[model samples]
Target: MPEVKRKYVTPGELVGKGRYNRTSNVYQIEDKFYSTRVGMAEVINDSLRVIPLTGPYIPREDDLVVGKIIDHSAFAWEVDINSCFSSFLLAQSVFGRDYSPARDSLTKKFAIGDLVTAKILAFDRTRDPLLSVSGPGLGRINQGEIVSISPTKVPRVIGKKGAMIKTIENYSKCRLTVGQNGLVMISGNPEGIILAKSALDLINHEAHTADLTQKVQDLLSGSNNGEKE
Candidate 1:
């Protein structure tokens, strides 16, 4: 009856089932003839993109993430970026040098519990994605603890690119990276980090909600108001 933005569509049925009308980026409900976006829904005939409520974190291309230094070695530091598998950050990829030769690395710059801000360089069907901290204004993180969430929910936090994150940053008085693969790194005063993490968790939980922007605004407003009183 009414046309809406493309993002509003939900999953329809399994893919390749030879059912449902294909239109634009969505499949339509044969009965209602309503078009919907493709993802995380049944396609009737084709396999759907619907994921379980919870699944292993999968990394996609160009995901910005917060990396937690878990273990260190002579060559690279091991980081858990909330991916299906943890990733490695080579010393060369980062500005600070543990050393040179590529054989003996210095892990002192990063250690267990320290969080680093980085971006995914490459992700393939197999093997872990390579990450980098070499981008402009990007490098080893200075402070704060990393917060993790469902990879799918990352979009909600980032908000149609970077708009959503900018709001959270302004509201919480914290700096953060909403990673492509759902890895979030929060840095600021300890209190700010905690507040940022709380906001992140709520966004992840309510990703499918309508009026997401409004919901987040309300959440932040309530929190700030509570602090003042």
Candidate 2:
């Protein structure tokens, strides 16, 4: 595997050129790639992409996100997805063919303040994004504490091939469900949940550091040792 070179860049800063191709949050002029936003530039295997350091969550199809129910209409419930745009969870999306908003109360099924894990079915800048909770691992989050972090740091928390998250779960002895929109739900032993939250905080604080993985491991190890003593 190639070592990825990561660096922070400002708007219009040169990201890469030549063999490096641009991805999200960047632009190209001829052969030169430049960042269009304030973000971290990542170069991996001939591909270069900039991850925005600060911005609202841009909804993409099939993204599993954690959302809080804020309001409801006769046919759909409004969800705050930790983004500038709110999402809509329709009654039909939840109940399929049996759904009848007139016959059934939408609030009865999902009340305000309920945290839900749902998928983005469709998203359009002009209209509110559509969401669904019909898939596996997608539903009401009844147990667990929700932790919020910067959306850009989500990938780092997950790590490559889920190694970082696995490490956190093992060390904390907690079951974690991470949403792309920066909401994480931790469930298990109360102590483990606290440890998990602490681990996530460390990851968020040092996301730009190259040795972040090792630092996280060290942090967890120290926490575990304290518990033993």
* Top-scoring candidate (TM-score): 2
Please give the CA lDDT of all the candidate structures.
0.66, 0.88
Q: What lDDT does candidate 1 reach at residue 56?
A: 59
RMSD of each: 6.3, 2.9
True lDDT of residue 22, candidate 1: 40
lDDT of 1 by residue, 1-229 (tens): 3332223334453233334444333444443333243343334332233423344567766767777788876667788887667787777666455457555435556777777777778778887777787777566677566677887677677888788888888888988866666677777887777767777877877777669788677777664555531
Q: lDDT for model 1, please.
A: 0.66
- The local lDDT score (0 to 100) that residue 101 gets in candidate 2 is 69
